[model samples]
Target: MALAVEERRETVAAGAARDRFRWWGPVGVAVFAGVLRLWDLPYPNAFVFDETYYPKDAWSLLQQGYEAVWPDNANELILGVPQVIPLSQEGAFVAHPPLGKWAIAVGERFWGLHPFGWRIVVAVLGALSVLILARIGRRLFRSTLLGCVAALLLSVDGLQFVMSRVGLLDGVSAFFVLAAFGCLLVDRDRTRELLRAARAEGGRAGDELRLGGRPWRVAAGVLLGAACAVKWNGLQVLAVFTVLTLLWDRAGRRAAGAWRPWRSMLRRDLWPAALSMVGSALVVYVLSWSGWFASDGGYGRHWADGRAGLSPERTPLVDVPLPQVSMSWVPAPLRSLWHYHAQMYDFNTGLSSPHTYQSNPWSWLVQGRPVSMYWEQVPDGQRGCASADGCASQILALGTPFLWWTACFALAYVLYRWFFRRDWRSGAILAGVAGIYLPWFQYQHRTTFSFYMVLLVPFLCLAVTQMLGAMLGPAGCPPRRRRWGAAGAGLIVLAIVGCFAYFHPLYTAEVIPMSEWRDRMWFTSWI
Candidate 1:
């Protein structure tokens, strides 16, 4: 009896050790990634790419509570040239929503409008995303090592690294989408556990399982809302995840031995899930426009007020008549807001302008065309380049080649597992990829860039890590086989890391000899 008790104690101790490792391992990887993202963040010292629009708009939002137009030389003024352009009170007509600019403003709020000031929040978001991915991987795969591998892969990915370093909306949107997905995963597990407990308590089959107060699902709703507020693309994720959550509820009921699992899930779970996920998300999305609502000078804030003079036929797409019903009780701002949304929708759909760096959605997975966010040719003796040939400094939004190529194969493997093996984890990962990727196909004729693929990279890494777990084989495999599998996976990961290093100069604006820059380009499309 003593021997048996001692063995049990040893097992408990071993489990405790594993739990501790799981908690700390991801934290360590996050710290490493954070250092890389945060180090020398102000190096470029200029507005890179769309930073010209976003950072300035962020400053306007901070100062005026709405995005205001600036003087003609606003870019030069903000970039610290001699010009003294002031932001006008008139609202700036921006294509995207205000939440992402608001997020950027948070950083500029603390620090002045320098490079680091506008970009700090994105960098922080990027680093935190690594931690979130690691934790999500742990929960999805039930292995801390795989979790760390996912985190490591994200930390070294060039596109992720560049998006994090720059002030961009997509990185912020990616973070919230990832966080929402993670929360839904937690909700799935919690709902299953609760159902299991209810079954053990002698509940009759087909009875309603009142798994009440799903805070995780509510959290997911809020995050998804934040994502939509950042970019409309997040709505795709919201739709896919809502269906996924309901399906999971059905699966949970079936596992709990409910006599009519689908019916019980629909009757018991549908409304509550909808209210928590869709209803809450709607509330959050509306609230995100508070800045626009609060400011009268905002663009289109008075769009409806002017309709009194216009005829119903004057409206291009939708016929609008003067308000007859005394919506006098209704706020004028809300009426104006409705009209503004129609115009914004038209703008978004009609945008088909060609861009030099625009890439087709089909080639996004293979990194066919990388958008150059910033570039400069330094003289022979400038910016620490002493070479006889002029040096090239650039910030190219590209993914590490080995990692992306490997993920392509892993994604195929995930499709097989999702269809044939009926793996829920594979389904979950693919759902994220589909939500972010498939919608781009609809807009294929419009200008899109590879950097938008930043949203899909986390899911790709997860898929790759899942395949790596499969490569490691079943838990009962021979030690020799496990060793070989580990060696093979490690070699692939190491190769990806090496590729990241080779492309580091391009991701950052590191001035390198022209020959070295050419060597890193690999393809003319990258230039």
Candidate 2:
């Protein structure tokens, strides 16, 4: 009897330890990630790659309530000690939406229009992404260890690291998508639990059940909308995920032994799900353009005010008064916004200008071509360079090679699990990949870059972590098999970390011997 009590006490202690680790491990990893992204963030002291566009736009939004044109010497003047914001009153045509720039403006409002100012919000978002992914992995895999592993993998990824350090829209958009995904995951669990409870409470299996207002699903919609507000591609994700959730509802009803599960889902769940996710998303997306709509100086804000054909007008081309837009009754601001969207769509789709660093989507998983966000040749005795030959400083937006390559295999494995084993977790991860990554394939002919894969990195990390969890095997497996599997998984993780360390210099604009930089460049295409 005494021994039984002792064993029970031991088991309780072990469970408590796991509970503590479940929280602390992910938090610890997030803190580590935050440090990696935030350390010396202001170094290089210049706009890196697309930073030339987004940060400037952000500053303009803060001052003028719209993106305004800047002078030719804006970069030089902005970098000076006494910074000058040379913003023109005239609005500029921007392809993407304003939410991302607004996020950067938040940082700039606090720190001024400097590197640290523009980059801080994204860096913080990036770190929060790590924590979010960790929690998400934990929920998906039912293992805190795997969750922390996933967070660690993302934290060390070169592309994620570089994108986080730079002021860019993709990383910001990715954060919203990830958060929305997490919200859906929570909704899935909550829905299942509610179904099970109803069944237990003497409710018939075929009874039409009404789950209360699913706040999580509503939150997911708003987040996905925010993602769209950052970039238009987020609309694709919102569409796919909306379908995914409805399908999940069907599956949940079927699992609860409901007759005609699909019919029931349509009858009971369809419209509510649509309203919570799609309706909320549309609201958030439009609201994100408040600055543009509110400001008279915004590009195209007055587009419909004096346009002859927009309103019924006697035109030379037509005998009767004819309106160019059939929906002439629409409000002017919304009509102008729609016209602006049409132009944005055309510009984004038609862009095929040649860029030296442009890469194909097919080559993204292999790190075939990395964008050089910043590059400079530092002469000896300058910028702390100690080499006899000139040192090179660069921030190459590349994924850690071994990690990415492993993710390729993991992705295949996940597809198999989703197809053959019918794993919901695998399907969810693949849904994210499809939403973010597959859309780019349609734009293949248009100029695309591998760094755009930043949006897909979180899903890839989740896949890799899931595979590692499988390698660790199920708990009931033979001890020897578990040991060997754990060893193999551990080695792969170590290799990923080692590769991250090896390429750390490239992710940060660290000055190193040109030979060393060249050595890290595994492919000529990477240059």
Q: Can you tell me which runs of candidate 1 are displaced by over 4 Å?
A: 1-15, 81-85, 205-207, 306-330
lDDT of candidate 2 over 13-102, digit per residue (tens): 999998899999999999999999999999879999999999999998999889998899888888986656556889999999999999
lDDT of 1 by residue, 1-527 (tens): 99999999999999999888998999999999999999999989899999988988888888888889878776667777544456788998888888999999999999878899999999999999999999999999998999999999999999999999998899999999999999999999998888888888876633576788999999999999999999889999999999899989988899888889888888998999899998989888889889888888899888767453222322335545444444445566776766566666668767888899999999999999989999999999887988888899999999999999999999999999999999999999989988999998998668788899899999999999998888888789999999989988889899999999999999889999998988887888887
Question: What does each candidate score in C-alpha RMSD?
Answer: 2.7, 3.6
- Write down the lDDT of every candidate, Cα atoms only: 0.89, 0.91
Clashes of 2: 0
Q: Residue 327 deviation, candidate 2, in Å?
A: 2.9
- The lDDT, on a scale of 0 to 1, for candidate 1 is 0.89
**Model 2, global lDDT:** 0.91
Name the lDDT value of residue 352 in candidate 1.
84
